[model samples]
Target: MKQPLLTTDFLDRAVDLFADDVGIVAEDGTEYTYGEVGDRVNRLSNALRERGVEKGDRVALLSKNSHYFIETLYATTQLGALFVPLNFRLQPEEYDYLVGDSDPDVFITDAEHAGTVTHLQDEGGVDEWICYDADDAEAGQWDDYEAVLEAASPDQPERPDISEDDDATILYTSGTTGDPKGVVHTHRTQHYHAMVHAHHVEFEDDDVLLWTSPMFHINGWGHIYGLTGIGGKHVIVRDFDPQTVFERIVEHDVSFLGGAPTVLNFLLEHNEEHDVETTGANPVRVETAASPPPKRTIRRTEDELGWRIIHAYGATETGPLITTSNSPRRIQDGDKYDIVNKPGFATINTEVRVVDEDGNDVPCDDETKGEVIARGNQILDRYWNKPEATEEAFTDRVEGWFHTGDIATMDANKMLTIVDRKKDVIISGGENISSIEVQDVLYDHPDVRLAAVIGVPHEKWGETPKALVVPHDGADLTEEEIIEFTRDRLAHYKCPTSVEFREDLPQTSTGKIQKFELREDYWNDDEDRRVN
Candidate 1:
């Protein structure tokens, strides 16, 4: 009596029940009914089929936020082909490795980013090139996206027999070294992950989501399935702007949106200066992840913006949703920010543990820190064509669990607070310091707009903590003043030994700060230099 759990079920259900509803609001403000969207998907799938895309073939897409991105996702997966969406922010030179690895049968590009990968098409091993807005793309034999759909039959494309366990999509994550690792997810993994995500996030047909985050990121944090399946509307935002975010949320009656902590920080800074409207006809709740946000940031979001925070944690390899802090019961008993600020508990159908090097669980005392490992259905099936890397990932400390590489502490309530990344931890004279803890203290300073704490070389303490602060517009900050600010709140050892003021910090396309790039500047090829 059990039906197969497939990602296709999401769009199929939307087309069946909410076919006439405005399902997608495009980047250019065009709206498409679910029926129209499904027709477009069918047509695209038919076109791809004619182009020799079969089951097991890979169809890679390089685009920013757009409605066609969703269409391309469902269309490729509908035919049981693996859909590989490249990070649109990547440089043209970076695609050489990604394209060669995935070896997609067809490569699709948005006109805006088509040129980024156009130079790789011939020698890149991709058989076909399909460009959206072909008129604007670089001149080539690229088939126009709309024309391909227009010429193809609007009838539903013939779907190959697909199993829940079949490989669905390959998401590439920047590896610590070497080439970016392709994390593989199956139909069952994404399908089950979406259902659990929808239940926890409380999505509904009436809910409207603003695409402040890119769809390329773990399939918009897996919302493309959960929200679409629930028949909610998606309003696209290709380029993130605080003013535009406010405009679209109120314009679209957006009830839900997700972004990294850095994104929220930008919005907070923008709202403080411009005092932009925060909400619309519906209440808004933001799902923040990518990196652990400062405690003050969460409190400001709730207090200043009057929006609820749903803090969750995970990575590209672990379904990106194995933990969350949106528990209503815990919220009623606990301090509001205390619960949401930390990655509270393992999500439904997921298991999380903080263990030491010997695989022993750490005490739930909130003071002890250990590496966080997760076991979940949403955990990736494998690393695409990288079996050795996959094996090394799973067997690190625990035998079978997926090692998250995040250092954390589980409270008596079993709510885990991530202290720092395993590598980001600063050890000074044998005492461990959590960089996140120090950063959180800096955020409490009203003049501090943004902050990143990293360990730097020290003559005495082996390696000591340093702070990079981006101050408020006109507020003047001094190193000694910033030093005393942290000393008042945190342990002397954890406080920054030095403070450097900057106008801004480097961030990923999704708004997460690139801490590795910051670290690389301080420590280069000095194995003896790390605070490790």
Candidate 2:
């Protein structure tokens, strides 16, 4: 009665019970049932084995949101191989660095990025190359993805004896500071996250999830596992097009999905041009992470769009679901804006705390800020190859809790509100100011579309808060007007001293604004760049 928990159990359950149900609807409008998808996973596993990918070998994939990505995840894990999903937006040199670091045995990519891999095949250190949507003539040493699947038998391969502690995947962080670190997760850790997510979001077998977020980002925040485990249908879109997303929700009857606040903003903007009913008998529920949406955006999303919004907070090391704002009663009785604004309570079986510099619990007076730390079965065990980084991440200020490097405050109800990244906090005239607080005020402006706040080198104050804003499509917003707008709401020190208009802000693949990039030009002349 003591069977080990494994990720393969999710696919096995779906195959055994929901085989006849539609499991995936690709962007090409082709549908595949659970039974058919299961066959493909088996065939892919067999093909990898034939290619000499043994247990513990790293199988890396670089592709967009597609059915092939899902198959690769199950196939790689089924054979007890560690899956490494790479960000497609990275440069060739960045890809070279990751491939070199992870030491993947097989590197797989789609046609759009085949050239990048082909150029790196000489020095990428990968043993095998697999290309999807590649012509046989163009694929030199690379194996065609479809051809390999076509040649392999559909029989399920013999799975290796995998333990719950076995490494299931190595997800690379965004590398805001320097080179990306590989955050390794065990089968049990991921399984726990999937179970918690399924329970928190109340995912049912009838739920249809749209793939708005890339599958590469924490396995689309674990929906690839959590949603699939429930035998829910997945509608895969190649990319996030506001109009296309609205169309898919209606076309596939999508019940749930996840994205960042930026994606939600895009959908809201799209609705201004076209009419789309997001709420009805089956109102679409969206799970948003990254930065918390401004209170105005949250209210508009629910009242105007009619879609329920769930806010969550976590990092790559925390299985990406440490806390979620998912209380039905709170949303029903309390102010919806206030409830959804907070990151909500710690997830089931997870412990989240805000600790001071000495590792003591911060007062839950709702105004005191401290470093957010988490400990649970779902937290990552270590970095892949960096022992020093691994040690520092876990034992820096606390013994067991993973230091999240985020500053947050917990309310009396235990709802957590993130203030800012520890490194992004602006210090002006010896006073600390949260960049998120300033950006939230800027987001309230009717002319602003997306905004980022960074601390720039100042002669007198040492460092001052500067704002970079992207205005609405047709709004001709002036810097003086934008500065006055924020000055009216927030404290004078927290308001931006200057404002710069841009067409768009630099963002990571997950829709997080890269503040470091915004600060680069401003702090270039200074030898000692004050990140704080």
Candidate 3:
């Protein structure tokens, strides 16, 4: 006999199993127990029903990582409604486009962001706004979430019987060309992904999982459901700061945390100059994705901070945890230089390949690079309302595999390494410059906190690499210095001809630099703008 598959239904079951146990520690020090969490989710679901949110209705949320954010998601799931989470970092104009595209039945937002929601509402056609705190709010004409829940029912209906192939989420992903497309996933895909994470990263029932990453990001790598299914603790944080993260890890004795290279770099850089230590007997584990980690920082994280960092690679369409580097030998014996830069192996049940433009599988001889494609139980079902886009993503024509458009290579041992995003390569003076390579060199500079590289227009070279940098706090910087820093490390053509300083760089909710946004300013004037 086989065991039953875990599903979203198991999320509420965890509340019952862990009832009275602490569920979340808010940024402001507020604690919500499992019982309270269950109650809130129940009330939110009831309130959503009161607004006539039927099964399959799109209910969107735009907010920071908070207890309420988690509640809204589970609440939406309980009713079989699609949970469409907007990136809180998106500007109002971008939000307008997403709102229009998703066409959500109800838009929930925190009071601080009420103004933007209202502005969006005024532009016409949204059904309603549910504000987190509307008691003394300035954004008029919106339902106060707390007020509505006070009178709302807390008796949750039986969990809907959603099919394994039924749509569960629709994540919008940015493209190199045109507007972002919504990548849709199903309950079966997500549940399978959760199991893969458990196998790859060893998520035990006793683990206390931290939400340093956004809940909107592949549902926190399915840990929201995966951890709950195993009766693990959930720790919530609204934002990431080195001191805040360190304190929480110690305070809650957190066993696991996940983020992108940006967050890991911040923690490592901050810890190097400050004294930080874990109070727990075991060192905590940090999971990184989005971009591969830099070799130097990976070493610093392990040697100086005494924390272990592992890499997992996937896109929003695939539920974000398909492949992970988690074997004990990989952790113990693998070179930091190699492991940090590689995308690792496919998780159990995930099949990955490096294929040429013709869709033929490239030889795994370490030297041959090709487009990285994957097919697995975790792959998304479709793109919501966009059949053409869905068809293109699922079938790359060559091998019937879902093409990721990312260039990569694999060793004989099957440790996968990323070459570059097929679309982000900088072709200048007939030479291909990997933007990641240039950016990695820039990050090696002691004064650079964050860096992104994109192609800018150039008459002589056709296109030249441009660098956008955020210097370490209180560090003085100049364009000449940035160019000089990369000059010795990278080829002359790959070195940035121009540099721009920002107090902070723009990032997606997943902590990926919004290179598309950075590329926009450079191409605004040209009608036929092509970065390469």
Candidate 4:
């Protein structure tokens, strides 16, 4: 009656119920069945234990998406070691900072980041190095990942008496705002989050999921748990390539995948050029987040790509999935877009509220905007080793609710539509303008490929909206044309006062536009600049 919940339950389920089923398709075309993967996971766990990695030790992984990456996740957690996934896109300096901060007992990575790993071990004092793709000589000092597994016994290690609240993983935030904060999630939190995620996404054993989102980002938005829990197959990709994604989906018969709006745009453009076939008996379900895609893009995903789009919203701290736009079947097709466009209701076992500055819930009139706050079993309890940051995240105004720092509005149906990030809101001449609103308008322009709205310092208005536009190939769109385009669609004050054209916008590893990076130059000396 009082059994502790753990993420390993998903792994156990997969091994027990779907032993012969193909569990993962690696980027290099290697396939691992559930039973084989489970054996490898046990061997990896035993190897870590043999190397003196004990419970509560942090084991850092810095690699692209692969079978090795997923196997390491299960193995590290099974031994009750805290899994710390490093963003592979980070520089050596960033790696040093993360490795130093986490103080992992063992560091596992691939050949691609061997240089970074070498730097970290030399400079950051990383205790042990395990290289998955290294040759015997290349891995002379470090442990070869395969060799360690080969030498270790395949028997499953005795289960540690792990508590539900025991730390399972430490996922560092994207560091878009500041130095990355390590968001720690317990086994219970991950398990509950996965269960709710599986429920909302309708994951089934027959479903073949694609790894569009990076495994480093909130554990691929909990798919590593949710899909695995349902015994679904995962098609892993090292990076998001439009053509590669298309091929994998068709090849694996991928039922679902998740990504940011930018990823969807790339796929759409790829389809236009190559006409990648997505039509099949199983329509691939595309879950988009990080910023809501324009309704037009969502419609095109369904009409052109023959995929159903599910929009959801959350951050790394909220088990990365608090709200989803899974609509009822009875809703008319015409009204479905509206449902999918909104972030929709809180997932089961989660409470999501839009609150005013004073922490009181805003009216669900669909007009009043407020900061979104969430509290759930899956929500993180604290930032690892950062008490001040943890305190700041959970305000005294709301006891349990974690301040999401996202500005949003809720409809009468409790459907939440994100207006903008709290800092991304353009406050011009005392009026709060949602940057998302301006960007949504800019997206309507046929020539615009990608658009990002930032609050640029203005002498008159404190800060005025500025638009960064990436035009379609061969399209010569003028700055004036973009400004006038938004001016006609939005309020003059809400429209961008100036526009800047770029071949592309600065983005995080997860494909989210780094608006703060864009804002730094404009607001460098401005005292009104908000830093989170």
Q: Which stretches of candidate 1 lie above 4 Å from their native place?
A: 527-532
lDDT value for model 3:
0.79
440-494 in candidate 3: lDDT tens per residue? 8988888889999988888998788999999998899999999998998877878
| C-alpha lDDT values of all predictions | 0.90, 0.88, 0.79, 0.86
| Model 3 bad stretches (over 4 Å) | 1-6, 120-126, 278-281, 331-333, 397-399, 473-503, 524-532
TM-score of each: 0.97, 0.97, 0.91, 0.97
TM-score of 4: 0.97
Candidate 4 local lDDT, 354-420, one digit each (tens): 9998889999998899999999999996899899989988875586679988999998888899999
Q: How far in Å is the alpha carbon of 150 misplaced in model 3?
A: 2.9
Ordering by lDDT: 1, 2, 4, 3
The collision pairs in model 2 are none
- The most accurate candidate by lDDT is 1
Per-residue alpha-carbon lDDT of candidate 1 for residues 62-133, written as tens digits (9 for 90 to 100)? 988999899999999999999999998888999988988999999999788888887876684788899988
Residue 97 deviation, candidate 2, in Å?
A: 0.9
Candidate 2, residues 381-408: lDDT per residue as tens digits? Answer: 7998999999988987799889999999
